[model samples]
Target chain A: MAGEVKFGILSCANIARTLISAMKLLPEVKIHAIASRSLDKVQSFAAANDVPKETKLYGSYEELLDDDEVDALYVPLPTGLHVEWVLKAAAKKKHILIEKPPAHTVKELDVMLEALQKNGLQYMDGTMWMHHPRTHKMEAVLHDSSTIGRICEVHSTFNYSAEVAYRRKGGLSADVRGNPNLDGLGALGDIGWYCVRGILWAYDYEMPKSVTAHPGASYNEKGVIVSCGATFVWEDGRTATFTTSFNTGHVMKLLVVGVNGSLENDDFVLPARADRAGFKVVSNTSWKDVLGGWNRTEDVQEVTLEIPQEAHMVREFARLVASIRDGSGAVEPRWAEISRKTQVLLDAVKESIENGLKTIDV
Target chain B: MAGEVKFGILSCANIARTLISAMKLLPEVKIHAIASRSLDKVQSFAAANDVPKETKLYGSYEELLDDDEVDALYVPLPTGLHVEWVLKAAAKKKHILIEKPPAHTVKELDVMLEALQKNGLQYMDGTMWMHHPRTHKMEAVLHDSSTIGRICEVHSTFNYSAEVAYRRKGGLSADVRGNPNLDGLGALGDIGWYCVRGILWAYDYEMPKSVTAHPGASYNEKGVIVSCGATFVWEDGRTATFTTSFNTGHVMKLLVVGVNGSLENDDFVLPARADRAGFKVVSNTSWKDVLGGWNRTEDVQEVTLEIPQEAHMVREFARLVASIRDGSGAVEPRWAEISRKTQVLLDAVKESIENGLKTIDV
Candidate 1:
């Protein structure tokens, strides 16, 4: 709080590259330290991302956790290692910015949350888009009873065609996403996390009554899901469906239909343009032409982004960490609560898929 | 066979107003006659559309069917009356252009198909978009294999909010879509018809192996579905989901995600503009930046429409009828088959819904 929120990087994952660059853009945040199992990977990542000379480099995560200069930590490790490192960082009293699929399971997330709360450490996931100015604007519309009305149906998808040269050249079985000892949850954890989060965000994070996985889940040779879909049902009859894949062309879309209006965007997960983000809204529709087709008015609301979404996420997390450090704020349970609901929904979907698309109560 | 194809219209349904106008746009088609049980309704309809004075007007459908000058008939009557009038029109050896949900049930559609085939009369359902030049272009991309690649998933939806002054004043119980006795299938028959057709079109008419209805289907007091969704699964693991509603803001979208690429348009059921229609395609996408987000290269392919899709439909139907009349061609049979397949899928969805979201084979 007195100087800056000094952050420590816990892994050298590919996502860490972008995240570290994003964190560097914030004047109130400093890269205090970086650590990786392989010292060479840590040195290369720090060099490529322009980590300052004063930033400590460590060959082991334990050394980074022991650094008293670090005020916060960012975890971009694989799902399997999240619980171990998250608990260690929490015990060190470092505010945390953890990557998605916050933990391998809801129980693991519970442990991480308990540790953070007991230590009075701030916690937030790396769902960068949630901090974007566009998201707040979209949320205003979705929450306004006059604009989007009551949510009736939501459909979200996040997919990318990963059947490219690298996939073929590397022979996917050994890929981190496909490796059982690494990110064993596969595409469901990697991408479907966004889809499930999108649905929960649209409905104000109210968990669904039940979830049912759809058929056609494709898995790799190592039995990690590469593609999957599911349906969520609420007690009020509102329903949502989402699909995610690593086997199709890149597509990230969210469509929310309501009784009075609707909101939609093709780049819900990642804004197509970094400088600007927008979503289309429609309202007061009726039958206009003789063809019995509809007549609805649409308006594109754009939000100018002075700082990229990832940077905004880092700034938000840093602000929360600074507030807690200065005794001006308590940890916001909202972020971790949202992540847990998303994890619970994902677990239900996976269980339903394992049970052959049977209905599973959330 | 001669100068023009004569079309007799049975019923003064609102859709006939559009169909009659579309037919009038075709040079080789004539609005030869009009009929309704209420003579005043028929007279008003003819006058409102400026029907040629030479065109006959009848107080009853039987009179129009008996007219020897009428070579073909377009039936836009309510679903409850489709079978009765279709059989009578077939008995008159009139080529038929029937409205969608050509029958209340698949069995009813079978009866009408048999009548048309037995009578050796050409038949085509009024699914106007099928004849759109834009459709032909989109089909080329979807089927090219090199462009959209093999279809992996399809998502389609068609919904419109019925909250206008007229609807409020009329209170909607008497509206055909909400009236079980008139259009029993409600949103499923009226809008889901297009969604199912879009999927079938993408797959080149290969019927899905199974369909499972989703929960949250809204129904009217008479037990007519006002909103519904279903998932279609193919033997090859391809999947499709469709949602339709009469209680939401207008939305018409078809998204086709493939292994190599994707094709999508916001106005798949109805082109946003009549003059030109376009769909966005993306392929061979990769990360162009270091944001850890994908960079999908998109191209908007536009197809000019010389005539409205509805007019194109009329012209195509007239051309087929002319060929049959001149002895240069037999009935196409293709249009009828497509309608039947759509009906079969609709029936399966309805059965799945009735059975509590149980999977039903097509």
Candidate 2:
């Protein structure tokens, strides 16, 4: 426990509550501090969530960063604020775990990543599903040429209907995600981030040659994208597509098709159950003789987990933090690299949407 | 049985063999004749498929069409030949069940359809899944607002890897689907027809305002498209996308997302089993409190069938033919209209692909 990574949560955002609960399962991770612009809000959040009595509560993010006991920070601020707080956290030598759509653009993210690298601080975007055991199993199948052959296409979707209260407000200006000033990327940055990441992960992070936005993207009154989709094409004829929205029913699906097989998971971002996650794989698929039906149906594969995916994410992040703290490893660049590629594609999609849905060179 | 519709088979194509087998289950249908360019080939096919001893065998399509006993024609000729044979069949007053991508172009299909309409002949394309009981069940869910409200997006894919012998021929020109002179549209016309039809079916035959082909369409040496995708956008902001290929594993997936729910089926085109077909639906989908996992997972709904979908298709066609022959009904316009809309979209996709992936007005 001496090398425990103490996490100072920078906001009382709803997502932070989930992270706090996940951290509870890891001894290597400690909820060292909670901070908010409002001291009363931080106090209520901590007391309501049963935060340890000894854990520090800060009225401002600066106070938490200045706390010598806090070794890392979980910045769940609006995307617009990531660069500012992340740069400040790196300056303070705090390892950072930030929310996704890591920045408004790849250039913005590169600045923060550079600062984190210079400070020898660990950095990872909070894409919890990346750490799930099921994800690893799916990857194993994807990598096996005999199982999937050469990757041909990938399709991912992440969508959810906004609450009635949010939609009834007319402009949804009150919600950070729908407010252009707070999260300009809107649904694309919030939920679409997961879809873009899922597609990239299936392709093993190979950068697509071009990105084209599908037409008819829905936008809020403030010109923030509420729903949109885009297609990605690789130089080798492999293609991928993703759709994201805050104006549709919840759906998190990822499908990867290859020359000989396919893999699909409906709850790729978050499983239907915390105790286990499942995906369906169909290998060497063909029609039955005489074309009556399929010769073989997809097999549903499940991976049971001792802890939820979010907890696994916390444990993994903490393990990296601990290694860096003990001088046993340099900062892991894989997470930062993945986040950068996702952000790059996210920016390309936005660019394509803005420019008459023309295909953008990635 | 006195008014049984006698169907004349055109060519000994592999698909015709399946149709002949399906027709065996329909007492209202009788195989009156089998035809091919070669009399020996037709004789071999009739023998191999166990055609009834009384059925006629013809050395040419014209000879079969001339047989007065044949009330309808099952035309499984390559797409390039549809216009010629379909027009000839209409002139002969034979009801027609032609294979999909009914013609290479909508103009050609329009000519054939006009001739059929003027001749008072029943016309239907060979899209077997449309006749499946499971398709009706899935449609009921899609139409129910409470189950899946306000459809927003649809995605369909129909892909199958070419046989090794076809690919080993260096250009796949040996296969009709891969030969520009025979089926120039190639995958887009063959498998892609199902995807376009599936999308149109999901949208209730509503015509899209625009169609845009995705980049990276693969082609054989003869300039026939072997793989491609396209996006369709409606006037009401509903969007649909489809991918089809002869260079990937078998995949028949359809996903429809609405404001309140979603429906998905992996085997949308062909069921994995002949006796039962299934689709999954998730209503009012939402994340669990605290964003842990899905509140409710998709429920797989299966519809048991008394006969295979192909048999269902054959029976339905036969019923229509019987009705027309018995003076109980005139030619049904619904089937022709559905086929027309699908062909229009299919042509638009090809035009878009040929025109630098431009967005084409539907």
Worst ten in a row by lDDT for model 2 chain A = A163-172
Q: For candidate 1, give the lDDT.
A: 0.86
Model 1: CAPRI class: medium
Report the error of model 1 at residue A258, Å: 2.1
The regions of model 1 sitting more than 4 angstroms off are A165-172, A291-294, B163-169
Superposed on the true chain A, the predicted chain A of model 1 yields a TM-score of: 0.96
lDDT of 2 by residue, B1-362 (tens): 67778999999998898898888877888988999999999999989987889889999999998898899999999988998898889889999999887988899999999999999998999999999999999999989888889898898988888754266555467889888878878999888999999898898889999999887788988899988999899998889889888887888889898888889888888888888888989875766766368775567899998878888888888888888888997788999999999989989999998998889998
What is the DockQ for all candidates, taken in turn? 0.53, 0.67
Model 2, A220-267: lDDT tens digits are: 888999889999999988999888878778888898998888898988
Local accuracy of candidate 1 as per-residue lDDT tens digits, A1-362: 35699999998887888887787788899988999997898888788877789888999999999999899999988888888898888888888898887876798889999999999888899998899999999999998999878898899988876556247557456567777667877889988999999999999998899998877788998888888889899998888999898877777999999987789988887887788878999887666566434566788999988778999999999988888888888888898889899999999999988996888988
